[model samples]
Target: MAGAAELFVWWVLAVVLQVFLTGPLSWLEWTVAAGAAVPAAFGARAVRRASGAGSGGGARALHAVLVWPVALVADTGRLASLTLRALRGRQVRGRFQTLELGRGTGAAWACTLLSATPGAYAVGLGRGRFVLVHTLPGPPGVLADALTDGRRS
Candidate 1:
């Protein structure tokens, strides 16, 4: 099932790219696209299986698409501001701290989302489901607060 999903996604992307880069897709172009997509899709499926992430790849992908863009833009703005401040010779102190993320899949999801935010990275999981993260100089709770704040809404 995952392989089929990956194959479909890649083929769609290839067709779009081919059309944009060249022109309307010819039968030859489509055959070439399918040939290329097959191996890539299988490779992706293999990796996904190895990762042991829960099923429903399509849902996870959809959730990411819905939530990521706004979060990314906000994080980018914050990171740029911090960078400008540092360039002005202001002293900055970054630190590592552990945040209490509840157990199970939600914790895993939160850790991944926090890691993707700018100016922060989840180093690893800590004792009791805590997520150890490093962040640019700011309140120790900044990232944690951001994560929880999003949850409330």
Candidate 2:
């Protein structure tokens, strides 16, 4: 079941990415996107199984899905600002912030969502609630707050 879900999700996302990032696409491009999604999807499933994160979650996964769109846009804009600054001979200031993380599958999902954005990458998960994230310096975005689990240490 998880494998099916992964495959479906991957296929959908790949198609969407190709369509959005490349503008108008030909049938061959669509086929390539779909063909590429299969192996990636299975690989994700295999990793999840090996890591014991296949247990998944309920509302938490839904929440991450909801938070994703907002975070993606905000992070992209932040990276763009950083790029503009760099181009104008200004220093690009990226920083690391430790954010609170949940346990088990929740932690994995949170990290995945946080890392998907351009401005932030979930660098490592330390002992306990330490999720080290490298991101462009800015006010905490909605995703960080969502993943923080309302506990700031």
Candidate 3:
């Protein structure tokens, strides 16, 4: 029952966001939001009831939407430079490197950082323990060493 209510709430929220973000809202949009809201609110209430705590869904959703722009911009710059060097045929060396990563979300973040940066690609991940990366112009051993060193510090 609680699960059903949460699902309903999610549906309503989705409709509301869609309308709010992409309006001039028509009557149809408002109607949809209204129809979805009941289920959504009910589901949200159920989820809260079952969990014995208030849901952080709203905060988490907002955070997820707002947190990526800076990272994306930084990554784009790195990729552009790396791509230009590759196009110039500048002695590009590519090799695989395995990095030890911190557990859980930390490892995921590290992988994202590596893949987002230019000249490096995360090819594989292993259970939040290690990541296999392919880096151009060789291993960037010095850069890798610096990063690993920083992690230690």
What is the C-alpha local distance difference test score of each model? 0.58, 0.73, 0.54
Q: Candidate 2: which pairs clash?
A: none
TM-score of 3: 0.37
The whole-model C-alpha lDDT of candidate 2 against the native structure comes to 0.73
Which model scores highest in lDDT? 2
Task: Give the per-residue lDDT digits (tens) of candidate 2, residues 35-75.
Answer: 88777767766665675544355666677778878889988
Model 3 ranges off by over 4 Å: 1-68, 106-120, 126-128, 136-153
Model 1 misplacement above 4 A: 1-65, 106-109, 139-153
Please give, for residues 37-130, the per-residue lDDT of candidate 1 as tens digits.
6676566455546755433334444454356556667667877887888899987667786666422334444555667667568887655546
Lowest lDDT sum, 10 consecutive residues, model 2, at: 101-110
- Candidate 2 residue 141 Cα shift, in angstroms, is 1.1
Could you tell me every candidate's TM-score relative to the true structure?
0.51, 0.76, 0.37
Clashes of 2: 0
Looking at candidate 1, what is the lDDT of residue 55?
32
> In candidate 3, how many Å is residue 49 off?
25
Report the Cα lDDT for residue 47, model 2: 67
